[model samples]
Target: RPGKEPEVDLPYYHPRAPSAEVEMTAYVLLAALKTEPAPSQEELSFSSLIAKWISSQQNPNGGFSSTQDTVVALQALSQYGAVTYAKSGAASKVTLRSGGEFQQDFQVDATNRLLLQRVPLPQVPGEYSTEVSGEGCVYLQTSLRYNVQPMQEDAPFTLHVSTIPETCADSKAHKVFDIGINVSYTGERNGSNMVIVDVKMLSGFIPLKSSVRKLERHPIIERTELSTNHVLVYLEK
Candidate 1:
């Protein structure tokens, strides 16, 4: 069967740190903005919320914890600033104040809208606030567009099967057999990809997994529905 390309949503939270999740969410939002045609107001609101969440997770050092997290978070913030939180053409100022002791301001304009502005927050145990009154706010709308490909017609493939022990050793009624399956793909382009095989057993015969091996790639036993008397195996190359 042919594969499909589908767009998946970014989760609001993940098992990792909040910063990593925020970065992933930002990447998804930016990707949607680029690929989608139009977005709804609700989506804009949700994306804004996610951006604010990402901002909140910033550490006093102005970066995330691990190297990977920091790199992704910074990239996400840069994308958000470029595609979502861009400033207007008119001159605007954003202020940051902490514990009534620290204060700073940044000037923004449409020419530098794509630039990411970072304000390091102090590690002091106190309150901090940011105020922005400008011609534009930090919000944008985007849609996620993607398509799924239809299954293609199956092409002819080669399969070789052999039974071990040549014949059943014990009584015919209770004897078991070991089946060896060899799948060969001589197709072009990467030589091979992935193939799925289905094996159905009759009313009296049973399948056992005493030994299983593959040559070119690993085999995955995806489905083993004993109730349905069907077994599905996946081979990757």
Candidate 2:
């Protein structure tokens, strides 16, 4: 429905209803358009409305009503800044030295140019100084990419988790105790949806066998693996 039209008008059933989700999605779309190498005419048309809606959702403290919406909106805005305002290509030189013990010089030019670099240095403890000079910009910040790692899975709805005991007992003599936990999902979804809750425990704690039970609702499957420190609870929406 988004791509079918250049602009979208959010429809609200009630005047007092919150529009965080719709506004956040539109902010993400606007961010994508701002970061495009070359935006089309359709994307350009939605620019004004997207900015207006996103700004309207911002609170006085510079945050959204919901944590998830804030995260998505900030991510979109940051991506736009990184792509749109990238430094221009020009000649540059960077020199680094650590207490005069180690020194390295880097030059960026047409013949000797690099998109990535790795400079191995010996372990030394001292104050370091870097001097960047030339016509262009020098970026020292590094981007960490985890390609093989799995993307974090978000809960389909909002979750509120609470435990009975605020502080854990400090003991080492084979302690056995009872803990009560309450989990509430606040997102609206159909009854046929599936919710998978994964719990991982820290070292030295093991879940008791046949201890997991739903006091209020029924679950499809409940399992625990002590070896890997994992507990999985699956429930229907």
Candidate 3:
């Protein structure tokens, strides 16, 4: 219905309010889209919209809602970009303006499509607007980060981390140490979503796999993984 002359949306309603089955269908659809060859205009148009929606779901870190979704969505969208490579040799002018005083322009075309173009804003607290008037796709990302200290009780999630055998306590016992982690979900929902904890090992030190296995057996831990320099822990909430 998406590419129709008078388009109508697909009904997403189910007999019951919510179901995991419906959510699983999303992955299946993404997998099918990844393998699909959109030869026809209709399929291409629909897939383009799906790709846009997936891009919109990207987090500030340039990933989708979750690690798994990010991997699958990117695989599908990467293929989409390859098929839609510009052939008309079109260009887009991206104009950034703030309060009619600060302005900058960038040109995007096939030759420089994959290049990163950065424009620094002079003003810290300024209202800005952007205008794009040409054909091909242009992805723009702005980075501004700050730290906030939330009140202890008001924080959505709380973490307490410590290590056994304090540095002052031992010389020979320093060969191995135990790390303790305590986390709590304090949000309004029943619980938080799946959480990924990434621990980077100090130089010349690697986490013991046996210790990681002990975490995997914990009732609350969903999974644990070991990589070259990082230990990843997944928690299901």
Candidate 4:
């Protein structure tokens, strides 16, 4: 077992071990220290010292970087509520402009709210626009559109109904019904009306009573006992 590359338990690696980037190393060490149970008073003091050291390296633009450092240090400090070089202290403010451009400023604040203002935009004339506000946190912004069309007075119609087996074994077969309504009007360029048709499926050869007196006159036809599996109905007018 001497040269057998000691079964290195990868997960228990040291918290203070150097990473490829100093910022990443500090972040990982801080995270580990935060999670470790019953850390000694000396360890706590060391963690505070490192936090201050990382805070000192904060960048003016809210992003930290060194020539040899792969990870940005200011961003890491922002996550831990530490003020790097940000005038506002703990929050990173990002400003976005048209054409997919953005700028970021970092600040450390004890209160979480980060107020950003004075964002300038290029003006476009004669275009109607409105902004909507909502309560709770503003996590995202998006645009939406809605359109409405006039209903048709005269249109063709179709109706269908059937019984099918339920997916679950313990349940009985269910009578599934679907009504397809299609209406088209020709004269004067009028919109189509939605015709609501009532459908009924009788189990046996006996005909079921229907509120609709006759299918043809009512702009609909009710077909019953067409087959053992299902029944079909449609608008006769």
Task: Please list the residue runs of candidate 3 whose C-alpha ends up more than 4 Å from where it truly belongs after superposition.
Answer: 1-37, 153-237
TM-score-based ranking, best first?
3, 1, 2, 4
lDDT of each: 0.58, 0.55, 0.71, 0.40
For residues 95-126, what per-residue lDDT tens digits would candidate 3 score against the true structure? 99999588999999878888879888888767
Off by over 4 Å in 4: 1-21, 31-34, 38-41, 66-237
> Taking the tens digit of each residue's C-alpha lDDT, what string does model 2 give over 146-232?
235456976645555543344455453245444444455654554446656776654677666556643224444443233356666
lDDT of 1 by residue, 1-237 (tens): 234433444433222345446567667666644535655666666666766766666664567656776777677666656565433466667877887679978776777654666655564445767677777653221122235676696555778877665666656535666557787775555566666777775468665543322322344443333334555676554
State in Å the error of residue 89, model 2: 24
Cα-based lDDT at residue 117, candidate 3: 90
Q: Total backbone clashes of model 2?
A: 0
* Best of the candidates, TM-score: 3
**Residue 206 in model 2: lDDT:** 69
Residue 125 of candidate 1: its Cα lDDT?
A: 45
Best by lDDT: 3
**Which consecutive 10 residues in model 1 have the weakest lDDT in total?**
137-146
* Poorest lDDT segment (10 consecutive residues) of candidate 3: 12-21
- Per-model TM-score, in order, reads 0.35, 0.30, 0.49, 0.22
Question: Which pairs clash inside model 3?
Answer: none
